[model samples]
Target: DGVEDDAMIQHAQVFGKPRTPDGRVLERALSARSSKSGKAYREVVKLIIRPPRAEYDVKKLGPTPFTYVRRFRGGKQTVMRTEFAVVNQRQDVELKCSQWKPVGAHLHELPCVLYLHGNASCRLEALQVLKVVLELGCTLCCVDMAGSGLSEGEFVSLGHFEKFDAEAVLHELRSGGRSNGKVALWGRSMGAATALMCTAKLDPLVSCVIADSAFASLPMLVHDLLDEKVGSVLVDACVEINQCVGCS
Candidate 1:
């Protein structure tokens, strides 16, 4: 009994029990594994909403005057940096943008392909496929999503709120005459989910959508992670506590 009590104390310290709004203990039957499951659920929620900000040298990717000479097009394309502000849920989000376009090409002339980076990543991730995009004869544009990289935001709602950011960027591009009204989306992971969500609403403006490694459902993904952490028996309880805490 003494050893059991000590184990319980250790579990309480490591994985706190779920509580009600008034701080009343809710589930006394919670084992150490169950407590761990609840903790994992909350941690996953925190991670999803506030992922670690990815920082890197923008100069290494390319700033203004960084030109790429096309082999067949017989001209040099340059990368240009731009900034725009988007207001979502009354939060002012300033997006840092970069455009790679052929020299002397008018913005309204070439089709634009907006690249959306994954979670905890910045616009510089587009550098991986920059050459392929350039070869496709389409203008490539990349932006730092809100709550990631240089964008201003306190939280990230994954595809829920990020889709709006993508929409706003597209709107700015078209309305401001920065784009030719022809746009394609290329997104990876979280960005892929955002692209799919945004495309559903703005199918008319989006010429194509290329989603890479997007989750089928966010909730299912969280559930699977929790199951892996603690097992199926505690998954429901953890999910319930997470929902109650408004993390879901």
Candidate 2:
């Protein structure tokens, strides 16, 4: 019931306004259970506080270092896509980005946040967030991970394989002369774990990271899933095999 209580608390906060002697304080509003199961069951529920929403005045940014319309193999129509250039490093690559630049935007090399979506999610999932990022005078790049969006690949290595893709995008940005500005990495679920691993390996150019609902480790997450079918020992063995194949 933690989830249930949180839902109820949020609902109460929405409909019931605070009543007080002075007027109506927005603070003191709802009453809820204090403990999971205890004598002190009756208690005023603390309303969840949220950061105020920020609005931005954004201008559209068109065509980066590598932007073009290209067609995939087989008789097909051409579609606009971001392209990347190979950089001199261990599989590091750069991606042409899509951003909305606000008017009067200073040529200041504004910091950027590269967004990595969850399993089966694509760069399109973060478009709304990108708009907000632009409003704050920050740049954003949404990566279509290998096999997930437009990036080339046949299968997803979950976090294990996707981490490489994350590194490639970062390397490309840094190599393409975005070094002077700050870089923040944001990811959700599997992408979040990938971002964390990428941050640990990359240089100081990565300034910060924002991870949403990330698992602890790639192996651990797989182990948890497999444990229900086999056992911990078998799960551990599978992890060892995966490591031997240079998966993690």
lDDT of 2 by residue, 1-248 (tens): 56654653443334323344442332221221332421122111211111111222222222233222223322322112243433223323332234333333432356767888887666666665754565444666767665455444434445655676777767666656543356788899877877887788654567888999898765677566656655554444434333432344
TM-score of 2: 0.54
User: lDDT at 17 for candidate 2?
Assistant: 33
What TM-score would every model get versus the actual structure? 0.73, 0.54
* Predicted structure with the largest TM-score when compared to the true one: 1
- The 10-residue segment with the lowest total lDDT in model 1: 8-17
Residue ranges of candidate 2 with Cα displaced over 4 Å: 1-97, 103-108, 177-180, 226-240, 245-248
C-alpha lDDT of all candidate models, in order: 0.69, 0.51
Per-residue CA lDDT of candidate 1, range 204-242, in tens? 569999999887766566676666765655555444433
Worst 10 residues of 2 by lDDT: 42-51
- The CA lDDT at 193 in model 2 is 78
Off by over 4 Å in 1: 1-41, 69-86, 230-248
